[model samples]
Target: KYRNLLLPMHMAIRCHEYLRHTAAAQITYKITRSRSIQVELGKAESFRETLKATQGPCNTSKPSMLDFVNKAKWDAWKSLGSVSQEEARQQYVDLISSLVGTEAPAVAAQPTGSTKGFQTLLVSTEDNITTIRLNRPEKKNAITVEMYNELIEALDLAGKDDSVITVITGSGDYYCSGNDLNNFTKIPEGGVEKLAKESGELLRRYVKVYIDFPKPLIGVINGPAVGVSVTLLGLFDVVYATEKATFHTPFSQLGQSPEGCSSYLFPKIMGAAKASEMLLFNKKLTAAQACEVGLVTEVFPESSFQSEVWTRLKAYAKLPRNSLALSKQLIRVVEKEKLHAVNDAEVERLVERWLSDECMQAIMSFFQAKSKL
Candidate 1:
């Protein structure tokens, strides 16, 4: 833990403590031994206990490697290039497994199905519950233009595949870090103005898919969700989140506006003040806070989040399919007209925003910083 915890002053103290632990215990860690990050064999057998003892203040709030990685913060891409969502997710699962002293089951390829051949996502259906995982954990599951296009196809496929419900979740520790900036670097032959128009249309169409989803869309907030990814939660029928999950919409900070009809629904569900803070002031909400304010359906402990969310989803999938569909449709009936209008409005606003000097300033400033690096 000390190795990953990033402490400068504790080196010598850690060295002394490590030596003490080594004298008391038999094994120093496999590679590290600065402070004997090992448990006394007879003192604790459980992984959690051993971890707690080996790393004092095991749950410290200090900046950590895991946190930085999970948050997708990097100086540049070289050290941890552009990893696919699936790979990033596996890295997170592996990290958690290491912390708990167990090898997590690798997310294996499902037997051949419609989900096959996808590069940025994993699709599978079991017990009538179709799951669409944002599989690019390598970039913190950041959505690329291709991913957005693929998701449109995946959701449409699920709608017709006799799947009763579709569950959307991130592959690993982070739900989504939003749009991959690389998507912008590839300007089409027409230039950025043309690209901006196309981007707005692409987002507009995708948001429509969310608005008109034939089946219930459930979001499993396995970890933090950022940017446009958080905006779509408003369209989810139900949302389950782990304690570690956070919903951050930094639109104002990033020179964007709320998409996915969040501008319409967030105020209705969480009140205008909260919505303003999230959309305009750059607010971040944790799992419990999200649930209390109605952004999340339920919150579960991180240790058992996967089991808890899937168990309920599978059971829900067993209910009468038509009944679920009809129920969802009926509930959404009142919002049909409003959703369409807001989606278009958001698109118009987004197009104007892209052309605005404010947004250009933000983009230029960001790229300038990157260039300096």
Candidate 2:
């Protein structure tokens, strides 16, 4: 009888603790109504926290004030559902529109001084050029989540910075090896779908950023440009790769499809057959081969690679930045651009294939083989 009587009290205390912890966590609101509601809810939470900290165990049958507030707030929210539904939708649309209309925040504006989300990409302005470098040579400058975010963030910042006439490279040894496979295993449940969506969005944003950018986006591929690195090369206005440099896309080897609209861009740069061969066979190309395919503008000797890249960029920088940017836009004007469609189709297909038994078995087999090795 005593234990049964204590059960409700124990349950209420646990509930109180849970709600207190939940309130302590940072919350995000997507719409104006949600923000307003969250603010009100936060105030109620403060009251509940205060009560929880101060109030002694009640001997009475009456409910506590904190419990009363929680139930009241929840009931009020439920009552307002019909009234808030349309307003909530409109606020969301407005928020999205506002975001789309405003210029993206500059990398320089960030207090963190990081690009995308990487702490490794060091950004510096030299003369009229913005130099961005991947600082993680220890990992062969392999693209991690932070690195990927930083790349896009840096590009976005450069795009908005009018003083940046040309963006130059500043990484040692390797341009980028590929996406970090170790990071791949850490992805959460439904991460693949989330990544696909995010990748598509990032690709679209990058394309617009590059196309409408006031300055030339030059790429100095100092070494290997593999996976996302190679696809990103297609986004640049001009690319200079060292003789020692190589480019590759190993999507097929990983049981995934091409990304960053490589499907459309590669075929446009190289011939359709060559693009198909590279993507399907997971082929690696020398800098000279990349140049031959019209994917790269020039290949310099490894000894003078840095100097050659800067020399070409300096020549480009001598031209009015707007003129160079306009020329790039003109050159690509006739190219049948279908990046978004291709990205969506590829992602849809990839998700379907990723869920397939064949792909699962292949991935499992590869991991097993790797473990043995």
TM-scores, one per candidate: 0.68, 0.61
lDDT minimum window of 10 residues, candidate 2: 24-33
Clashing pairs in 1: 18-35, 18-36, 83-138, 84-136, 85-135, 85-136, 85-137, 86-135, 88-137
Candidate 1 lDDT trough over 10 residues, lowest sum: 39-48
Maximum-lDDT candidate:
1
212 in model 2: Cα distance from truth in Å? 5.2
lDDT of 1 by residue, 196-261 (tens): 899999999999999999888999888999988899899999999999999999888767788889
RMSD of each: 24.2, 21.9
For model 1, give the RMSD to the true fold. Answer: 24.2
